[model samples]
Every structure is written in structure tokens, then in C-alpha cells.
Target: MPSLVPHLAAVIFVSALAACGEPSSQAAKAGPPPRPVLVKTVAYADRVTERSLVGTIRPRVETDLGFRVAGKVARRLVGVGDVVRGGQQLASLDEVDLGLQTEQAEAEARAAAASLRQAEADLVRTESLTSKGYSASASLDRQQAVTEEARGRLLRAERAMTLARNARSYAVLTADADGVVTATSIEPGQVVTAGQAAIRLARTNEKEAVVSIPESLLSLAKGRAAMTLWSNPGTRYEAKLREFAPSADPATRTYLARFSIPAADETVQIGMTATVTIAVPDRERVARLPLSALFNQGTGPAVWTVGTEGRPTLKPVDVAAYEAVEVLIGSGVEDGDRVVALGVSKLDPGQIVRVIEALQF
Candidate 1:
């Protein structure tokens, strides 16, 4: 009876150990709990909106500086990025040709003056002889006509000499206003035609942002805008629409728009990149979500949507625009659809998840 009792006790202990081992194996097979993630219920609303576009800082008034006369360049007094004042000499032409022209004009004037003196002497002699009846009236009339012709020639020569002097002065190209040279197309010994662009000067006082907008977005760019330099984005400057292209570019189909910055800082230089943003009235409602909610599979942009069963289903979304803090979604998830707002990269399609917090708006 004592042996039978020990056997019964061993069987009971072994049964208890087997029961504990079976439950642990089943729990191990079940795996860990669902991963916790932050989620939000998507809802569409008509919100005031703005769009940002990249642009370049440029002068509102860009002038092409050129020589008034065609000649070989003697020297280029300024270079690209050189700050210049009004009436500053930018370049000079070889004065050899201009000098010869001036000398020739002077010589012609001297010859005309000598001819005028001779004609006057002849007219005076002829008048005296005619008064004493020693010369014919016809001869006096001829001398008078000769004297008038010589006077006309002298006047023409003087005017020609003045024009030659002016031409010589024109050989030295000067700035029309205070500006910075943005480009130089001519160098020493380079021959440039009259009115050919030798240097590109941009006025220093007026600054503008030049950007290209697609045809679809041209209507929104009419009113006031904002500008921020690429290097210094924190400092924003108020800008107004100055001008825009009436027609679109054939290749790009984009219209060029220029925005005038009211008071741009000195640090904003020409050719520097900038961003222009303009607000437009929203025509339709859209779902706004934090940027962290976006995920790009091989196909396109998507977001993890949590279903009632706590399973995450990746829903493809059409992103309308990306803002500083949020992304505007045009379509994809409907209203009241729960979407994972954070830690999207860690999730998988149809993976089980637990929402730690629901984000409002």
C-alpha cells in the first residue's frame, strides 16, 4: 500500500509538469503583442493654402551695356560682379580710329575755312570793281553765290567735327546707373559692333525673384507673395507680382513670373537661389496629415491605415502638395479612416498594430 501511494504521487507530479510545459509552448507559438503606433482619423476640409516654388534672385532692371560705336576694344575696365556707380567707365575702344576721324574732320574744317576766306576776298574785290563799273554785275553775282557756297561748306565741316568729337567720347562706354556687372562679353582686342551687348549690368536698388510656373498654377500667382533666400530661409521678405510672361514656353510650357521684393537686404545677391510662396483659395477639401505619415513603396506614396481588426493596410494616396509641417492628400483614404501617423517605415502591409494615441486634425 505504501509503494502504490508513492507511484500515484509521482504520476500526479509528472502530469502537473506536462500541463505547465504544454501551455508555455502554446504561448510561444502565439508570438508577441501588436506593435504600438500613433494614428489619426483622416477627414477632408477646405483649408486656405499656399504653394512654394523655387526661383532665382535677380535685378528688376537688367541693362545690357554696349558700345555706341563699332571698334576694337582697347580695355575692359570692369568685370563680372564688379560694383559700379553711374557714369563709371566700363570699357574703352581703341581710340586710333576715332582719333584719325577727329583729325580728318579738323583738317576738312581748316580747308573749308581757307576756302571761305578766299571766297570772301574774291567777293569783296568783285563788289568794289562792280561799284566803280570796272566789273560786270554778272561777275559780282557769281562771287556772291561762291561766297554762300563756301559758308555752307564751312558750317557742314564744323558740324562734322563736332560729331567726330562726340563719336570719340562714345568710344568710352560708361554705366548708366549704379549697378553690378553681371556679365562681360568682350575682352581686350575683341571687336564689338555698335550696340552689341558688351556687359550686363543689374541695378542695385531694385531686386526681384524670377521663377517659372507651370500653366496649371499660373492663376494663383497674381497677388502678393513671399520670398526667402535659399541660404537664409528664416528671413522672409514681402514681394509683389511685378510682371509675368503672357505666353508659355513651348518646350517647358511654363510661364516666367517676376516678383518685386519691397526692401531686399544687401545679402540677397543676383543669381542666388530663392523660394517664392503664394497663397490661393482652396477649391476643394483635402485630408491633411503629418509628413511622417507618408511612405513610399516601389509603386508610389502611401500611408498605413489601421482597420477595425487592428491590422494595418497600406493605402495608396495622392499627395497634392507638401507643406512645412503637413502634407495635403488629394485622395486615397476616405473620411473616418484611421491612418498611422508616425513610425510608418517600421510597419508592414497587413501587420497587426495598436494605436497608442489618436491625433486630432
Candidate 2:
């Protein structure tokens, strides 16, 4: 029995070693093996990149309605928000003073005309007498000069009368374009100076969103494309990059982007805040990977990629922009390359790794 104890102990030790070396057949078949992460290959397409910004809706052009001549405002025909047509009288100044000036000018012009006529008659009489040898030639010449001077005075008086009529015409403040009155400063009986703003007018149904974009990102679009508008279910509106400021603002380091958004519906109003998204052109296709695939090497950006035989390799890449769930790669990688999406920072180059599974293609 003492000799059998050593053999039994040896046999138990060998059996325990075998059991630890090989998994049981039942345990291997009982549960499913851990599957690797699934990855899908990315397809190349012409996708317009978008950058969104908050903006404000304003009129393309606004004008202040003011009187060209000074007078007391006698009538105001339009109020704020009232739609008016071109040349429509928005307000009127007191015409009594202008009318009096016109009357005085007319009287002066009539008197000048009468005096000119009388001088002309006298000149005719003197010239006749001189021809008949009853008057001196010098006397006739003097009368003729007097008649010419009176005629010149009459012409000057007539011009003054016309100017007075024009001044009276200026008393009526008229709209320059068909627009809605946005403001008014004068009511009836209010005295106003020349060029005093009497009303503010803007195009009724024309609107645009003015956005300030960083100068670094503004070169993406030279012109325009479809943009998303914040109004109503986030409707897409066709916007054209009509104008851009030549200079960037020193304080904000941004340039102004003027988008020409067609106001098809009357619902668009001035001063309404808007969100602007400009679509950037896709020039070149580069490698795109998940955010977890990136790791900083203190010098720049780098990513881990699975090489042949499932070994991790460090690949340097230039990052253009960061997307929602992906980082846009500008260079240093080609399409269809396998990238380590997770645990990339924990890996060293040329290290052996077990692929978890395929991820997004």
C-alpha cells in the first residue's frame, strides 16, 4: 500500500496537467466563440461637406424715406409695416409756404414780362424816329439795350418760379421702391428738416442670411449650394453664395458670407434669426476612420493599422476636420486599408494582436 501511494500521487498530478492543457469538449461546444467586430469598406462618392452657423435674416437693401425739402409735415399716408409702391407718397409737408413762394415768383415773373414788353415798344418807337431822322441813333441804341436787359430779367424770374415749383414738389415724400414701411419718425403737423428721415422701407418678400465664417474654412465654397434652413422641419433652401467680404474682421478673424436665399413665401420677415450651413466641395478622397483609431504621437496625429499577419503598425495621417463619429483624413492613408478602431493607443508598432472583429467598412 506504501508503494501504491507514490504511483497514485504521480497519476493524479499527470491528469491535472492534462486537464489544464486541454479544454473539455463539452465546454468548447457549449458556448459560441467571441466574434470579431464587423467592419464595412467605405465607398467613394462626391459628398458636399457642410458647416453650420447661426445667422440673421435681413433685407438685401433698406432705405430711409426722407423729405428733400424742409417743411411742416401735414399728412402721413403710411405707417410701419404698410406695403407701398414705388413713387407712392408716404408723407407730405405743409404746402402753404411753398405755394406762397410760387405765387410771389409768378408775380415777379409777370412784372418782368410787362416791363420787357414796354421797353420793347419804346425801343421800336425810338428806332423808327431815328430812321425818320427825328431821333438820334445813340438814343435808339440805349432803348434797345434797355429792352434786352428787361428780357433777361424776365427769363431769370421764370427760372426762379420753376425752382419754387420744384421745391414744392419735394414736399411730398415718395417711396423709391416697392417695399414695406419699417419705420416712421414724423406724424401730421410735425416739422421736419431737409433730408429728415420720415420713414424706413425695405423689400417685403426678399430676405437673406448674413453669416460670418472663419476665414480658414471659407475657401471651401467659391460660390453656392443647397443649405438647410432652421425654419419648419428644417427645410432645405437653395442658397447661392452671392457675395463675400474681401477683408476679414480683425477682431473675429471671420469673413462675411452673404447668401442669396429666395423668399418664395411671405412668411420670411426681417430680423428673424437663421441658421446657415455652407456646403464645402469634396476635392480628394482620403482614408476615414473612427475617432478611437487616432492617437497623438506628441509630434502630430497617428493611427494604428492592422498589417499582414495581424500585426499593428503606426500610420501617420493628416487630419482635416473632425466629423460627428469619424475623423476626416486628408492624407497618409489609402482606401481599403485596415485600421485599428479600438485599443489603438495601447498597441505598439509590430505587436501581435487578435482581431476583435470587422468594423464599419
Candidate 3:
């Protein structure tokens, strides 16, 4: 047992020396430090001359369908989404009261006509009697006055008959043009006043997109066709300036612009969001960049550009406009120069970085 202890001791001593001879424990624990991230230069794409805006899909011409005479809505011949043609009946007002009034007027007119004929006959008899020296001049004058009164009454009755006929015709609501019913405000048994909107019909041929243009850009939008880029790409539509509000909105200071679309797709429905673009002439060239590229320059506007050495360099910029997710660079950036689209605020001058193409917005 004593001999075995000596041999174990020698073995332990040798192992410790061998481990020390190989390397220090601290030295072996450490590994190489991480390598610096790489950055690359990219040539920017040329910016296009297209301008854009936000707009709404609307009918080119919307006609309100209403009754000319006030009455209870007896029958609604058409409802919302129904297509109607010119002269098509859309609704009817209760004609009972109108019919009664018309009948009364007709009766009055007939009575007046009868009275006029009787007066004329009496006048002729009196004239014959006066010529034969059987009637006095004063009696003849009285007969003439009666005839004039009857003629005046007849004329008034004729006018009343004409008015009654017009009122009756107004009970039937008809479409002035071919269109689809966009809204229905009245139902059966509901009373509507004259000229009240019962239905809103939109003309099928004349479709339009209404856009509120910023007053600042109104000068640029003049003489330009407002275009619509449909939600589905590859579908494009355009319209001329149909109308524009002469006054600016008090709240937003924007002008209302209506553009007429000659033909619209069947799938195009009202109230859908449409992107509008109007060209502006004689405007300065703008370099559009992702909003992320904008950086804070202390207090004023600023941006970060990827310098020739692929390093972030802060630059002060004047912005013409800030749109959806992009910034229109009025100054401080060239069209074909690359700018740090994102992570610009986190970068510093002379610091290297790694830029990758963004796949998602």
C-alpha cells in the first residue's frame, strides 16, 4: 500500500506539469474577437416624373330621383343597386289626393265653360233685341259685362286644369337618364316632400373620381388629366377636369376636383379608394426616397446618405412634400445617389455598416 501511494503521487505531479507546459488556462479559454460588419455601395435607380395623390371613386353625374309633388310614397318601383333607363319609373307618390284635386279642377273648368256659352247666347239675344229697338242701352251694357266676366272665369279655369295635369304627372318619379340606383331614402308608406331625394342615381357612361387636391399643389394640377391607378395593378384610368371648386375648404384648405371618366369597369364600385396622379409642369425635379432615410438634423430637416465609401453621412435637406411612405427631396440629394433608407438615425459618420435590400415594407 505504501509503494502504490508513491507511484500515484508521481503520476499526479507529471500530469500537472504537462498541462502547464501546454498553455495557460486563461490563454486557452479566449478565442478570436468577432469581425467587423461589411458595407457595400449601390447605384440608385432613376426617379420617374410621375406625381400621385389620393382620390375617391364617384359617379360622373349623380341625379337625385324625387317627386315633383308632395305626397306619401305609395310604391317604390326600384331599390338600391337597380339599373334604370331613361323615362323608367322609379317610384310613385300617393295619387288619391292629387286625383281628387284634378277632378275638382276639371269640374270647375267645365262649369265655367258652360257658363261662358250661356252668357254668349244671352249677349247675342240682347244684341238682336237692341238692333230691333226692343232692349235698352243700359241693359245691353249690363249683358256685355256679364259676358266679359264669364270669359275671364273660363280663362282662369283653363289655367287651373293645366296646373292640375302638371301636378298629376309629377306623382310618377322617372329617371332622366340611364343610371344605377346608388341610394334609396324612402320606402313604401313614407311621405316625401316635393324635390326630396328619394333615390340617388348615377349615370353609367359618365363615371368619375373625385379628389381633394392640396391648395399648395393646385397650380401644378392645372391643365393636367387626373389619373387613377386601380387597386389592382395594370388597370389604369384617366379623366379630364370636369369641375373644381372655386373656393378652398376652410378646414383643410384643399380644393375639390372632379375628373370625368369616360368608361369604367363593371367591377368598379362607388366609394372605393382610388389613387390619383396629376402632372405638374415647370416644377423642380424631386428625388423621392423612403421615409426611413430622413434623419433629424438637430432642429431642421435632414437625411443620411451613403457616402462614396459606404459610410453614413448626415446631410440637411429641404423637403417639398411628405407622401404616403416616401419623401420628396427638394434639395440636398441627387436623383442617382444612394441614401440610407433605414437605420439611418442609428448610424454615425465614418462608421461602416451592412445594407441589405428590404423585402418587406
Model 2 misplaced regions, further than 4 Å: 1-41, 45-49, 214-227, 246-254, 262-265, 282-284, 287-321, 329-361
- Candidate 2 least-lDDT 10 residues: 34-43
Show where candidate 3 strays beyond 4 Å: 1-49, 263-268, 283-361
Lowest lDDT sum, 10 consecutive residues, model 3, at: 34-43
The models' CA-based lDDT, in order, is 0.91, 0.77, 0.78
Which candidate, 2 or 3, has the higher TM-score? 2
lDDT of 3 by residue, 35-131 (tens): 2322222233333445677788788788887888899989999888898999999998889999998999999999999999999999999999999
Candidate 1 ranges beyond 4 A from true positions: 1-47, 282-361
Query: Judged by lDDT relative to the true structure, which candidate is superior, 2 or 3?
Result: 3
Write candidate 1's Cα lDDT for 24-59 as tens digits: 899899977899999988889885667799999989
- Clashing residue pairs in candidate 3 are none
TM-score per prediction, in order, is 0.64, 0.68, 0.63
- In model 2, state the lDDT of residue 268: 58
User: Model 2 TM-score?
Assistant: 0.68
Write the residue-wise lDDT of candidate 2 on 1-361 in tens digits: 8989999999999999898867776687665443232232333444457777777777888888788889898999988889889888888889999999999999999999999999989988998899999999899889989999999999999999999999999988888888888888888978889988789999765677788988778764563555444565356677777778898899998888788787435655676667776667676665567787788869789877665576666778888778889887877666666777776656766456666555443
